[model samples]
Target chain A: MKKSFHLFYIFIVSISIVVLPSCTKQKGCTDNTATNYDSEAEEDDGSCTYNAETDVEIHFSSMVGTESLVYNQEYTINGRKVKFTRAQFYVSEIHLHQADGDLVHLEDKYLLVHGEEHAYSIGKVASEHYHGISFSVGLDSAANHSDPSTYAADHALSSLDPNYTHWNWNSGYVFIRLEGYVDTTAAANGDADFGFFYHVGFDEFKRDIDLDISQDLVGSTAEIGLEIDFAKFFLGVDMRTENSTHSMDNMMLAEKIADNADDAISAE
Target chain B: MLTMQFQLSKNINRLTNAGVIPAFVSFFLLLSSCGKDELISDTAYNLEIPKGFPAMDIPLDNQLTVQRVALGKKLFFDNILSRDSSVSCASCHLPEYGFSDPEQFSKGVEGRSGFRQSMTLTNVAYNTLFFWDGGATSLELQLLAPIENPGEMDMNMPELIERLSNNHEYPSLFREAYDREIDPFTITRALAAYERTLISGNSRYDKYMYHEKNDALTESEKRGLEVFNSSRTNCSQCHSGFNFTSFGFENNGLYEYFADSGRARVTTLHSDVGLFKIPTLRNIGVTAPYMHDGSLTTLEQVIEHYQAGGKLHENKSPLITGFQLTTQEKTDLLNFLNSLTDYEFISQTAE
Candidate 1:
């Protein structure tokens, strides 16, 4: 009897040990301990202050013109001086990768740069000094079909506006909107009205290009001044040789420029 | 004293042989009850495959089990998907009318009409593209459009995630649907998974094709297919294939001025002026009024418009060089289009 009682006691003890831990797991005991420990330490140390700020500036040439054939530039296209009317594009999801390996992610990533809408501007960073800025040249997939109602309310995230960008009930957005009639309808003559209309976005063909800039946002002010060259938008492609009625249907030139972001003359 | 001692000894022996007796039994029963509870909970969402339909394009990322589909169905029908609790996906796309609205445009959070017509959700899985302009290439992306659209559900991703996470029921459901963490992608994928099952391939026309049921088509329907494929119609060029869409946008000569630039608006090409995607004619009988703008109320009007070679011609489709079709052909073509209606699709349920 004595031996049997000893065995029973041992069995109960083993079961208790096993079942107790399971009970602790169900109660989420570990999570509570970890969080409490962290909070208590934080209270004692008075550290982890988010003291960081940075200014970002984006510059473009002509301040106008849609795709190619600069409208109102001092220089002439083929021979005739052209004047640009309007130019606008979307820049969104500004993510800053820091040297220390921390990321300073910006909210309201969408920024519309329209000559009429004033030079594009967005600022504020709470993380450590950033190393460099990485952003999409056009709208991200999620923001493309974003609801305008929510977008207007959350302007910090989405720069989409119906009146300005035309988030039609159908297509998400016109990534780059350049509108104005060409001077003449001839591909060969310099005097003909010719302009480029490149609405490059989520088609099956367009590639996603990551703009790599060797910028150091470390010590000083973590600000980045980006310059987009208007001159190189129209490269070897002869604008004067084209007529007004030509199709900007093919986006090979736009793709070339987007890919040629570095080669384009920078205007800061 | 001797008798009492013997009884006590007998009780001790029983207890020892039973291995802690009551306590052990209690523990085993507890474990068994837990297992039994799991079995009861495992009642499959009871998914019913539509007749004559192939296996759906179930997303690799979000597979549709019964529980997930049931959860998705509730969420789709629930007003909680909206920010202010004003709308659901079913608000715009109802289940009865082939998952399309009776009105041309649907009202949003603030009773505002969306700029475009509510698209039909029939056989949406077969769609290679979505929306009138084919903006979203996948069902995964299409879920975001209505949820985030101001004139639709009007919910942001963060707020949406918070709302779902906050709900006691949804968190558990999300945990079950995606064995991982809960986020926008999982939620969107689940919704997409439910929608992918909404195939409209069980229509009368489908029966005729797959089941060799000649009676599925009336004489008018047979004659209509003839006119539809004829040079005078040029309809089959775009509305071809089993799913009934070539996935090409054409300038149906809707307008000369560019208010709605259609594909041109997206591509910035002058040649694409007034061009819009050619929508599937499947279930056309129920999902009307029609067209991207929902301008045409009946199939007959749609046929007549095409018969008249459309209104504008600034950048009309090269294929639409005005074919001369008799009134009878137009009537016959409309009949064929009506036969494509899939009433059973509108009424399908996840059993």
Candidate 2:
């Protein structure tokens, strides 16, 4: 009977060694900071989920005076009626001023904003409050002269669709493309038959726009609203006489438009 | 040891039951087949550097390789680069005509004429800047312009990539040459690699000047060389050096009102208004219709234009002060220019 009892004890011990671990040690995400953290877990499963970093979405809207600007829509500017067929520009080298006085520079980032598209995510950043924002209207010299084909398909600098922003002959990106028809008639009553293109580009014509505004990005996402006023964009210029400028073709007009960009764009 | 054997047999039985064993064997066979298919032979290509010419400055990333040159030569002659596949680089730059088109302005897809004449690719590896306006900084970058220009190939980079990637033969060829898939980087580098091999320093002039061959040039041709180097003619002032071009942008007074605006289109400076990049005079006999506009049809017209001091323009080169040449001197100058043609360079078949 003692020998039988010893055998039973050995079997019990072997069973316990095999089965105790399965019952006692729970395998799950061991990180307490993770969203799916299991408090009862004693072993890590290498599966953990964490909160995403704060992302900033910059929204751009085109405006002609009071109403929102629409493509193929006519608007009166400088006492002349104009209708925009295409409106696009590149915004590059965005910088956000944090509340702690540290500037967050978004390196090698570019956004090819069009009249149709509204919002673009500038990617994730540290969660904090920002005081001001600064960005360039065009690409820097290095980015401007880089081979567009090297970029990914979805990249702003890629030579994909909506590629009219690049000047193939000149080997540079057109900073701002504002093409439309304007009424150049003497009485200003005729149809807007005159087509004008303001393709501002080249390194010298790149303009920097800085604005002081309050933005809190302490959450998962934050938004910044900006508007480009066409009425103010055509400020200090007579569209009837100055109907066209391909940057190098008419430097004076391109410079006027580039200089006027600071006042033309503002925080909404 | 018995337990280990049992465990091993059990694992093998499980694998066999799950059909993993056959799958593993087939996967290895597939991998071996792929290896055989992409057997890339990377043989180094020795570019024959012509005598009297400096060693070619090849990009570090794109060294000369036999497979790369062969692939580039095929691409050069292929018409698949265009939008409609109607024209190729060779269409505008024919190898027989010193890699230049006979037309005043080379036509593109659908017969669309370009603004400037197609420049010769003879010794194009020596060029510092590309295009009439010096728009492109490198030969690799220069190919992008012609490919994307609406008046040229009329094709974008993304589309070209798609087309090349879809081709059955190009992918393997590209893999063998560049060890990468077909992309802009490989395409541009390969084309440039072949063009850099177009060495043109085997002319009669080279024999006479560098090889010390006394009977290489005639007495009349010798006199023409004197006139060319003479300070009175100033021919060699802008068109200097072994390649016959200083590679500088100068307003040659081609126009008074400045229709095209030449180099100013790039620099945006008023002083650079009518300036265009000086072209190489090598193989001038075959690459005809001279000047950026291709307005002058013959060498005599070009010489006459220089003799007449070019058209009047404020930004004209100060060196454009005209010179006088006798009829015999004109023939000798013409003969000397013809001697620059390298029959071996142009007529040689692809290796």
For candidate 2, write residues A42-145 as lDDT tens digits: 76879887765588899888788887889878889888889988878889999999888888888777999877788988987777778988999998999998
Top candidate, metric lDDT: 2
- lDDT digits (tens) for residues B1-351 of candidate 1: 333334434444555556666556655554565454243343444445555545666655556677667677777888888878998889888887788898988988988787677888877877766787676657766777788788788877667877888888888887776654556666776787678667777777777777899998988878888888877778888788776877678888765575666777556667877878787788888888887788788877777677677766777876675677677767778788888887777775433
Question: B189-217 in candidate 2: lDDT tens per residue?
Answer: 88988888888888888899999997898
* TM-score of each candidate structure, all chains considered together: 0.57, 0.83
| DockQ, each predicted model | 0.07, 0.19
Question: Which residue runs of candidate 1 sit more than 4 Å off their true CA positions?
Answer: A1-268, B1-56, B312-314, B323-328, B348-351
Cα error, residue A128 of model 1, in Å, equals: 19
